[model samples]
Target chain A: MKVVVTGGTGMIGRKLIDSLLAMPELIDRDGNMAEVTAITAFDVVAPNPPLPDDPRLTIVTGEISDAEAVEALIDDDTDTVFHLAAVVSAQAEEDFDLGMRVNLDGTRITLERCRALGHVPRVVYASSVAAFGGNMPDVINDTVTPNPQTTYGVTKVIGEYLIDDYSRKGFIDGRALRLPTIVVRPGRPNKAASTWASSILREPLAGHSAICPVKEESKMWMLSPRRVVESFRHAQVLDAVAWGPHRVVNLPGVTGSVTESLQALSRAGGNSARARVTFEHDPFIQEIVDGWANTFETARGLEMGFKSDTGLDEIVNVFLEDDLPGQHVYYD
Target chain B: MKVVVTGGTGMIGRKLIDSLLAMPELIDRDGNMAEVTAITAFDVVAPNPPLPDDPRLTIVTGEISDAEAVEALIDDDTDTVFHLAAVVSAQAEEDFDLGMRVNLDGTRITLERCRALGHVPRVVYASSVAAFGGNMPDVINDTVTPNPQTTYGVTKVIGEYLIDDYSRKGFIDGRALRLPTIVVRPGRPNKAASTWASSILREPLAGHSAICPVKEESKMWMLSPRRVVESFRHAQVLDAVAWGPHRVVNLPGVTGSVTESLQALSRAGGNSARARVTFEHDPFIQEIVDGWANTFETARGLEMGFKSDTGLDEIVNVFLEDDLPGQHVYYD
Candidate 1:
C-alpha cells in the first residue's frame, strides 16, 4: 500500500511518519493487513532536519492548494491519505485570504483529487477543538454544534462536513478527527494562540524561561502528540460501519488549567524548572483562550477506542520521552 | 440602496422580489430605513413568466459560479445581496459535481466578490432545514449540531459557516436562515424529495391529480412562501447585535404530516381536491424524505421575531391567496 501524508514535515506529521515507518502495516480497503510498500510526504516545505533516509520514504514539496501538485502527489497506487496541512489559529485570524486559500480551498483540492482517483482511499483528515467556540455549553459533548469564531476553526469545521459528504457519496472512505490543543509541542512556539499551552510546559522542561500569557486558572482541552498519532492510526483501521455515516469525531482529551499544568511541570522538572515559568498576562490571548470549549465529553471517541493523555503530567512526560531529546538539535 | 438577489427567478426568490418592490425600503448598514433605488435579479435562467416589469427590477441571466459575472452583478453600488442560488436536493444528489460547483464554489465566489468591494454588504443567505439530518433528536432545537445527510444539505450548512465567517471578519454583514420545506408550491414538481410536500396540495388545488410518494404519517417541518419572504425581510432588518457572532438561525416552522396537509387541502378545495391525491410510494424518494429533520424548535428565530405559518391550513391558504392565480398563467 502506498500512503500519502500532507503536512508531513510538521510536528504531528513528522512523528506520524516515524511511527508509520517503524510499524507500517496499515489495514487496506479490503479489510486486510497490507504491507506499506511506499510512503510519500507532501508538504509546502522540506523537512528541517530531514526525515528518515529509508528508501521506502520519499519527501515532495509544493503548495497544497495547487490542484496539479496534489494530483501528481496522489495517484492510483495511493491506499490512504493522512491530510494534516493547515494554517494555525492566530495566523489564520491574521491573514484571512491565506487561510481560506490553504485551509478551505486546499482541502477541497485534495478531496477532489482523491475522488478523481475512483478507487476509494481511506482519508484521515485533521480537524480541531477550535471547531467549537462562542456561547458554548459548559461541557461540550458530541452533540454540540460547531459555531467557530475564527477563520481557522470555520475552515476545520467545513472540512469535516466535506469529509462526511465525500464519504457518504462513496468518493472516499474518510475520517475526520477534531484534535484538541496539542500540549508540549516540541521545538519553538509558532503562531497558534494555544502555542502558550505548549510553551509553558516545553520551555520550562528544557531549562529555558517561558511566558504564561493567560491567567493560571485559564484552562484548555489538550492531548499528547503520541496519543494523537495513535488516534490517527486507530481512525484509519476502523471499518466504515464503525464510523457510520457521520465521519467526524472529536477525539477524547484531558482538560487542565495552567495551574494544573504547572503542578505537573513541577512533578517532572521540579521547582527549579517550574520556576522558569513567569506570569505576564496578555488579555488578548486570554480573551481568545476564554472563548474555547475547554471541557468535553468525547463519548464517541472513547467508544471508538481513541485515547487521550491521562493528564497534563502524562502529556509533559510524552514530550520528555519522545520529543525532548531531539528538540535542542533541531531548533537551537 | 441597491440590492442583488441570486436565484431571483425561482419560487421564493420571485416572491421575495415582489415583497421588496412593494416595501421599497430596507435597513442599511447605518441602521436607517433606506429606499431601495435599484434591484438586480440574477439567476442561471431567465424567469419563465418573466419578473415584474417595474423600472426598478432588472433580471440578468448568468452562472453564479462565474466569478466575473458575480463581480459585475454585485458592484460597489450594491448595498445588500440575497444569495439564494443553489442546486436543489434530488438534482444535486444525481449530479455531485454540478452541485459543488454551483452551490459551494458559487457561494465562495460571491463572498469573495463582496469582500473585495470593502463596503460590507448585508447578505441574507438562504440555508435549509436540510442542514439537520441523520440520527436526530425527536425535536431539533437551536443547539443541535448540523449533521446533514445529503450533498444538498452539506452545501447549505457549509454556506451558513461561510456567511458567519465572512460576517465575523467584517467583510460582509451576513444572516443565514435555515428555511423549512416550502409547501403548496405552484409550479410542476421539481427534483427535490420534498417537492411532493407542495405537489400533494398544489396539483390537487389546481384540479390536477398528484402523487403522495411517502406514507401519510411522514411529516415535514414546513413554512409558506409568504412567510419565508417575510422572514428574509425580517432577517435583513434586524441589527447585527441581534445576530451576535453566529449569523445563522433555524427559522420558525410548523411540523405537519401528509395526512394533516391533506386535511388542510380538503378544507381549502373540498373533498374533490383531497380525492385528487393518491398514495404511490417511491422508496427512493421516501427514504430520502425519511432522512430529513421533520420537527424543530426555533427559539432564536422567534425571539428575533421571525414567524411561522399558523398551521398547514394557513400554508394552503397562502398558495391560494398569493401564488394560485399565477400558477396556471405561468405553467399551463
Candidate 2:
C-alpha cells in the first residue's frame, strides 16, 4: 500500500523512511506481508534523506500545516498516513498562540482536508509521552490518570481523541503511538529541552564535548530512534482487540537516572567519551527535567507484541555503528 | 472562606450550595480558619436558591462562559471556585455548536479569568467518566487511557487540562473530579440519556407510570446524589500531597446491568412500583445506553477518601421522601 509520512525531515522521520525503504517484513494480522507500493515523504522543511530517480519513492516538500500542501499529499488510492509533524514542547509551551496555530489548527486543517477527500487512510499518529504529566512516581501506571504538565501534552492527548473519534465514525483507521524521548540521534539536535540527553551522549561518543544541562540525578524515559520506528510500524498492524477503548498505547522505553546514563557512557566510551561530557545545570531545563515523568506501565503494549531496546548498551551499539560519522564511536 | 459555585441553579448545584450554607464547621483548611465572607453562585439560566437576604451571599445571573461574568465571580477574597457548569453529553453531542460554545468556551473563559486574578483559589472542576471511553470491557479501570467515544467527552477532557494547567502554573489550586452519573436524583431529571435509570425507578416507586427506553441487559455506572455531594466535599479538602500526580480522580459508583437495576427496583417498590414501570427501548436512548460505560477501577478514589455508593433503594427513598411534588401526577 502507498504510505505517506509527515515530518519526514525530522531526525526520527529520516530513519523511519530508511526503514520503509528496506522493505522489512511487515507483520499484519494475517501474518507477514512482502509488499508495500510506495512511500511518500512530506515535510515543512527539506526532505530528510533526499531520494532521487526512484519510481517507488516520492519526496514532496512543503509546509504540512498548509492546506494546499496537505491537499497535494492526499490521493484516492493512498492507504497509509503517518502524521509525525509537530512543534517541540519548549516552543509549544512558550508560545501559546503559535502552538495553537501549528499544533491545533494545522491538525484540524489536515483532518478537514482528509474529510473533504472522502477517502480514509490507515492513519498512524505520532503522539508523545508528554501526553502524561504532574507529580509522577517512579513508575507511572496510566491507571493513575493523566494530569498534563504542559500544553504539548494537552494537544497530543486531544489529538489522540480526534483520531479515535474519526476512526470510530469510519472516517479513518487511526492508531496513535505515544513515543518516549529518542536517544542517540545523529543530526544537529533541535531546541527541545530533552535534546541534551542525546546530544551529550552522542557528541561525547563522537569525540566532541557535550554539556549536560540538567543534574545527573535527574532521570528521563528514553528509547532509540530505531525503537521509535518500530513503534510506528507496530501502530500499522496492532490488533483491534488489544487496543480496546484506547487506540493509543504507551510505547516502552528504558527509564533511569542521568547518573546511570553517564555510567553507561563511561563503560562504553573508555575515558575519552566520559571526559567530553560535563554537567552544567540550566534552571529552565532543570525545571522541566524535574517535572518530567520517567516511568510508565506499558503492559498492554508489551502484551500486544510491541518491542523495546534491551538496555542502554543496545542503544549505544546501534548509534555507534550506524549513526556515527566515521570514527567507529562504539566506545573505543 | 469565599467560594464561587457555577451552574448553581441546577439540582445538584442548589443542593450543594444549601449544604455549604447549612454546614459551617466544614469550611476550614490547612490549619487556616477561613474568613467567611461570601458565597457567590452564578448560572446562565436562573439564579441559585435565592440566598438574597443573607449578607454573605451573592448571586449573579450571567453566563459563566462570559469573561466579565467570570471576572465578577472572582475577587480579592475568593478562596475556592466550584465549577459545576456543563451542557449534558446528549445535548452536547447532538448539537455540536452548543457544546463547543458552552462546555469548551465557558471552561477556557473560566480558566483565563482564574489565571488573570493572580490569587490562587481552590478550584473544584467537575469532570465525568464519559471522558474515558471506547469498546468498554465488562469492567474498565478509571485509568484505561481515555479514548473518548464522543464529543462531550472530548470537551470535558479539554476542560480538565485547562484547569490543570492553571493549577500547574500556580495560578489556581485546581482539582478535577470525574464524578459518576448521579442516581436517585432528587429533582425533575434533565434531558441526559442516563436520566431513564433514575426516572423509571423514581416515577414507579412514587406510584406513577414511567418509560424505560433501553433493554434489560444494558449496563450503566451510577452514584447516589448524596455520594456525589460527598465526593464534591472531599474534592475541596484533600491534601495536595495526597493528590500526587493525579489532580483528577474517578469518583466511585455501583456498576450493574439494567436487569439488576430493575430487579432492585422490584425488590424495593413491591408490586406498585413494578406495575408502573414499562419498557419501550427507544432506538435513540438505546444507542446511548448500550454505549455507556460503568465499570471503573475506582480503588484510587476510594483510597483518596471518596465514599462508595450503589444502592438504588436509597436513591429511590431520597426522591420519595424529599422531592416528590405535592401532586402525585408530578411523578407521572
Candidate 3:
C-alpha cells in the first residue's frame, strides 16, 4: 500500500507520520494485513526538526493550490490520503483570498486528482469543530446543521460536503472527521484563535509563564495529539460499509473549562506549575472562542469506536511523555 | 436603483420582472422609497414570449458561466440581483462539469462582481428543497442541515453558504430562499427530475395527455409561480436587520400527494382532464421522487411573512387565470 499525507511538515502531520512508520502494516478492506511500501510526506516546506530516517518515507514540498503538483503527488499508486494542509483560522480570517485559494481551491484540487485516479482511494480529511458556529444549540449533535461564521470554518464545511459528494459518486472512499481543539500541543503558539487553549497548558507545564487570553471559565472541546493521530489511522482502515451514506463524523472529545485545565495542570506539576499561568482577557480572542460550540453530543462518533482523552491531566501527561522527555519536574 | 435578474427568460423570472416593473420603487435601508430606474433580464436565450416590452426593461442574453460577462452585466449601478439561473438536477447529474461551471462557479462570479461594486447590493438567491436529502427527518425544518444528494442540489447549498458568508462580511445583503417544486408550469417539461410534478397538471390542463411517472401516493411540496415571484420581491425590499445572522429560509409551500393533485385537477377541469392523466411507473423517476422530503415545517418562512399556495385548487386556478386565459374549462 502507498499513502500520502498533505501538511506533512506540521506538528500533527509529523506525529501521525511517526505513528505510521512505527506500524507500517494496516488492515485492508478484505481483512488482510497490507504492508505500506511507500509513504510520501507532501507539504509546502520540509519538516523543521526533520523526520526520522525511514526507507519507505519520502518528503515532497510544493504549493497545495497547484493542481498539477497535487495531481503528480497523488499518483495512481496512492492508496490513501491524509489531507491536513490548511491555513489556520486566524490567518484565513485575515487574508480572505489566501484562505480561499489554499483552504477551498486546494482541497478541490486534491479531490479532483483523487477522482482522476479512479482507484477509489481512502481519503481521511482533517476537518475541525470550527464547522459549527452561528445560532448553534447549547450542545451540538450529528443532526445539528453547520452554520460556520468564519472563512476557515466555511472552507472546512465545504470540504466535508465535497468529500461526502465524492464518496457518494463512488469517485473516492472519503471520511471527514470534525476534530475538536487539540490541547497540550508541543510547539509554540500558531495563528489559530484556539492556540491559547494549548499555549496556557503547554507553556506553564514546561516551567514557563503563559498568557490565558480568555477567562478561566471559558470552555473548549478538546482532544489530545495522540488520540487524533489514532483517529486518522482508525478512520482510514474502517470498512466502507461502516460509513454508509454520510462520510462526515464529529470525533468525540473531553470538554474542559480553562479552570478545569488549570486544575489538571496543578495535579500533574503541582501548585507552582498552575501559578505560572496568568489571565489577560483579550476580547478579540474571547469573541471568537465564544462563537465556537464548546460542547457536543458525539453519539455517532463514540458508536464508531473513535476515542477521546480520558481527562485533561492525561492529555497533559501524553504531551510530557511524547514531547518534553528527560526534563526534570519541579515540586511545589 | 438598477436591478439584474439572471435566468430572466424563465417563467418565475419573467413574472418577477413584471412585478418589479409595475412597482418600480422599493424600500431602501434608511426607510425611504427608492425608484427602480432600470431592470435588466439576463439569460442564455432571449425570452420566447419576448417579456412585456417596457421602456425600463432591457434584455441581455449571454452565458451565466462567463465571469467577464457577469462582471460587465452587474456594474456599479446594479442595486439588486435575483440569481435564479442553474443547470437543473437531471442535467447536472448527467454532466457534472457543466453543472459545476454554471451553478457553482457562475454564482461565485456573480457574488465576486457584486463585492467589487463596493456598494452592498441585495442579492436574492433561488435555492431549492433538493438541498434536503439523505437520512432526513419525517418533516424538515429550518435547522435541518442540508445533505443534498444531487450535483445541482450540492451547488445550490454551496450558493447559500457563499451568500451567508458574503453577507456576514458586509459585502452584500443576501437572502437565500429554498423553493419547493413549482407546479402548473406553463412551459414544456425540462430535464429536472421533478419536471413531472408540473407536467402532470400542466399537460393535462392544456388539452394534452400527461404521464404520471410515480405512484399515486408520491407526494411533493409545491409552490405556485405567483407566490414564488412575490417571494423574490418580498425578500429584496426587507431590511437586512430582519434577516439577522442566518440569511437562508425554507419558503412555505403546500404538500400534496399525486392523487390529491389529480383530485384537484378533477375539481378544476372535471373527469376529462383527470382522465387525460395516465399512470406509467418509471423507476428512475420514482427513485428521485422517493428521495425528496415531501413534508416541511417552514416556521421560519411563515414567521418571515412568506406565503404558500392555499391549496392545490388555488394553484391550478392561478395557472388558469395567468397562463390559460380565455380557454374554456369543460365540466363533466
True contacts kept of each: 1.00, 0.58, 0.73
TM-score of chain A of each: 0.97, 0.90, 0.95
RMSD of each: 1.6, 5.7, 2.8
Give the alpha carbon lDDT tens digit for every residue of A57-162 in model 2: 7888877668888888867656677888877788888876566556765675666565565666667888888876665566876555555677778778777777
**DockQ of every model listed?**
0.94, 0.37, 0.79
Candidate 1 Cα misplacement greater than 4 A, ranges: A330-332, B330-332
* Candidate ordering by lDDT (highest first): 1, 3, 2
Give the TM-score of each candidate: 0.97, 0.76, 0.95
Tens-digit lDDT track of model 2 for B1-332 = 78888887776787777667766333343435455567888888766235546676778888766887788777766777788888878788777557766887788778767777676667888888887665556677655656567778888887777676667667677889887777777555578888888877777767777888888877777887767777787888776677765577788888766777777788878877787878886998888777767777888888988876646666655566656663255544
lDDT of 2 at B112: 69
Cα lDDT for residue A114, candidate 3: 91
Question: For candidate 3, lDDT tens digit of each residue in B88-199?
Answer: 8888888888998899889988998988988888899999998999889899988888999988888898898889988988888899999998887777777777888888
Q: Please, what are the lDDT tens digits per residue for candidate 1 over residues B168-277?
A: 99999999999998887767888777889999999888888999999999999999999999999999999999998999999999999999999999999999999999
Model number with the top DockQ = 1
